[model samples]
Target: MADERLIAALDVSTRAEAEKLVTQLGERVGYYKVGMELFYALGGDIVTWLKGERKKVFLDLKLHDIPNTVGNGICSLLRLRPDILNVHTAGGLRMMKAAAEALHSAAAEADIPCPKLIGVTVLTSMDAEDWAGLGHTEPVADSVLRRAKLAQEAGLDGVVASPAETAEIRRACGEDFLIVTPGIRPAGVSHDDQRRVMTPAGAIRSGASQIVVGRAIYAAEDPRAAAEAVLKEMEAV
Candidate 1:
């Protein structure tokens, strides 16, 4: 059951550390997120190693740039063959569309599976205050839904959004669109730097397609047991 929808964030900085965590979690976690910290250090080596171990990867580079640059970057990452990839939806419709097109075209040419191209609607670390500072007068929830719709229109598979907005995105984007939520802290755990978070069961109940968890598991004294607890919470829904 842990293998189904839980993604353990391999937040370590070295390939060896990531591999050690994977070995520790073993079959409990099949999906891993290699975000900027680790990806910057190892590049595609981490992804390739995960694939070699037959584990799924979410390459969370959060690409945001000019249309051409974002699209070209997606094309390059496709070679690593991550199961999922994401871009910043704030880059606007054109950039999202370019990433989708580039991902599909390159994967087709290479005869490999194209990673699901997800757009990031809003970050979990930001609450209303941070959002307001960015000059968004509209409600954060409203902005998240609007971005989700834009990502849909741009041909993105789905979005990386907070669990607080998962139900709305699910309602607006339909059941088929992927919604990967990252602000997941197990019950009784500290929220850490993430401001918009939900318990494991609550996220699944809110219609999250998948959940990414980091410190709640990795920082625990026993990571495998922590992962099992999260999985149990997920199945509680």
Candidate 2:
């Protein structure tokens, strides 16, 4: 059974380029992830435009800051009415809880649905070497699991992790928790800077609730065709 869990990463640098991809892919994908590059260029206007086109938006700012600052930032993002938002789990429990509570109060006051708040456990670009450099003695998976448990306790909806860690997160947090995996490269695709990656089918089967694909689709000769092909691969599982 297939789910509409594919989040198209709008990795372009400008709003026009991003919108062009959105128009090209159209409804072939249901969700779009507005990451730092595009967000920095166009700010909330890009999010507003995507919502106007009736697309679900995942605002992947990966916010990491002091609790008060993070809470205020969440307020500003909530007004955009994105379908999903996330913070860095490395920001710790206080920051994550503050984000969640800010989402709650903002949504209630504005009378809108609260976007699913997720924590980014660790970037897929890193591995055990990176963790060691951060002065941690544990393996990458252990660090991810520990941060995931903290996020859950902090009241986050779920976590953003590599496909390799999704099963562990699911085991620790249960089925209801969302696991959004990035670093997905379809078969025969270049891995780019991603050190840890999986095929879309592999990630989904590994207990990921959602998968994010950027270069695999956006950089293709025909983005729409690439997106459709990815959807097909996701459905095959």
| Per-residue accuracy of model 2 over 1-237 as CA lDDT, tens digit each | 223699999999987798789889876777999999999998899999988988889999999999999999999989899999999999999999999998899899998988999999989999888779989998999999999999999999999999999988999999999999999999999999998899999999999999999998899999988888888888899
For candidate 2, what is the lDDT?
A: 0.92
Residue 196 error for model 1, in Å?
A: 0.7
lDDT of 1 by residue, 2-111 (tens): 46599999998987888888999998899999999999998899999999999999999999999999999999888898999999999999999999998899999999
Cα error of candidate 1 at position 132, Å = 0.6
lDDT of each: 0.93, 0.92
Instruction: Give the number of the best model, judged by TM-score.
Output: 1
Question: Once superposed on the true structure, which residue ranges of model 1 sit more than 4 Å away at CA?
Answer: none
Best by lDDT: 1
List TM-scores for all candidates, in order.
0.98, 0.97
Q: Which run of 10 residues does model 1 get worst, by summed lDDT?
A: 1-10
